[model samples]
Target: MWSWVAHRITGFAIFFFLLVHVLDTSLVRVAPETYNAVIGTYKNPIMGIGEAGLVAAIVFHAFNGLRIVLIDFWAKGVKYQKRMFWIVLALFVVTMAGFLPRHLMHVFGGN
Candidate 1:
C-alpha cells in the first residue's frame, strides 16, 4: 500500500523534475546568459538538497518500476511482492547512500 503510494509520488516527482529540467535546458538555445543564470540558481544549498531529493526520487521510482514489471510478468513475483518491496527499498537506500555523498560533495565541495 505504502509502496504503491511512494511509487506514484516518486513518479510524479521525476516527471515534474524532468519537465523543469527540459524547460530550463531549452533556455540554452534562447540565450546562453539566461541559461547560465537559471542554472546558477541551482548552486544554492537549498537547491542542492532538492537535487539530492530529485536523485532519490529517480532512483526509487526506477527500482519500484522494475519491481512492478516483475510483479506483472513473473509468476512468482506476486507471491513475493512484499519481500520484493523490501528488497527494492533496501536497494534504494544503498543506491542513495552511494550517490548522495558524492553528489553533495560535488554540489557543496566548491570549485
Candidate 2:
C-alpha cells in the first residue's frame, strides 16, 4: 500500500520536474539573456541542494519502478514483493549515501 502511494507521488514529482526543465530550457530560444540569468542563479548552494534532492527522487523512483515491474512480470513476484521492497529501500540508502557526500563536497567545497 505504501509503496503504491510512494510510486504515484514520485511519478508526479518527476513529471513536474521534467515540465519545469523543458520550460527553462525553452527560455533559451525565446530570451537568451533571461535564460543566462536563470542558469546562473542555479549555480548557487540552494540550487545545488535542490539538484541533490532531484537526484534522490530520480534514483528512488527508478529503483521502485523496477521493483514494480518485477512484481508485475515475474512468476513469483507476489510472493517476494515484500523482500523486493526492502531491497529497493536498501538500494536507495546505499545510492544516496554514496552520492550525497560527493555532491555536498562539490556544492559546499570552495572551488
Candidate 3:
C-alpha cells in the first residue's frame, strides 16, 4: 500500500523535475548567457538540498520499479514482494549514504 503510494509520488516528482530540467536546458539553445544565468540560480544552498531530494526520489523510483517488474514477471516473486521491498529500502539507504556526503561536500564545501 505505502509502496504503491511512494512509487506514484516519486514518479510524479521525477516527471516534474524532468519537465523543469528540459525547460532550463533548452535555454542553452537560446543563448549561452541565458543558460548560464538560469543555471546560476541552482547554486544556492536551498537548491542543493532540493537536488539531494531529487536524487533520492530517482533512486527510490528506480528500485521500486524494478521490484514491481520482478513481481509481475517472475513466478515466485509475489511470494517475496514484502522482502523485496525491504531489500529495495536497504539499497536506497546504502546508496544515499554513499551519494549524499560526496554530493554535499561538492555543493557546500568551498571551491
Candidate 4:
C-alpha cells in the first residue's frame, strides 16, 4: 500500500516537473536571454528545495518502479518485497546525501 501511494505521488510529481521543464525549454526558442534569466532563478534557495524534491521523487519512483517490474516478471521478487522496500529506502538516503550538498551550493551562489 505504501509502495502504491509513493508511486502515484512520485508519478504526479515527475509529470509536473516535466511540464515545467518543457515550458522552460520552450522559452529558449522564444528568447535565449529570457530563458537564461529564468534558469538563473533556480539559484534561489526556494528553487533549490524544489530541485531536491524533484530528485527525491525521481529516485523513489525509479527504485520502486524497478521493484514493481521485478515482481511482475518474477515470483521471487514478491517473496522479497519487504526487503526491496528497505533497499529502496537505503538508496534514497544515499542518493540524497550526495545530491543535497551540490544542490545547496548551486542554490547558494556556487556558480
User: Per-prediction count of colliding residue pairs?
Assistant: 0, 0, 0, 0
Task: Provide the TM-score for each candidate, comma-separated.
Answer: 0.94, 0.88, 0.97, 0.92
Residue-level error in angstroms, candidate 1, position 83: 1.0
* Winner by lDDT between candidate 3 and candidate 2: 3
Model 2: residues with Cα > 4 Å off, grouped in runs: 30-33
Off by more than 4 A, model 3: none
Candidate 4's error at 6, in angstroms? Answer: 1.0
RMSD of 4: 1.2
Model 2 lDDT at residue 66? 95
Q: Please say which candidate is ahead in lDDT: 3 or 4.
A: 3
TM-score for candidate 4, please give it: 0.92
Q: What is the C-alpha lDDT of each candidate?
A: 0.92, 0.91, 0.96, 0.89
TM-score of 3: 0.97
**Where is model 1 more than 4 Å wrong at Cα?**
none
lDDT of 1 by residue, 1-34 (tens): 9989998899888888889999999999999999
Candidate 2 lDDT tens digits, 1-111: 998898888888989989989988888997889999887876799999998988888888999999989999999999999999999999999999999999999888988
Residues 1-111, candidate 4, lDDT per residue (tens digit)? 998999999999899889989998899898889999998887688888988989999999999999899888877989999899999999989988998887787778646
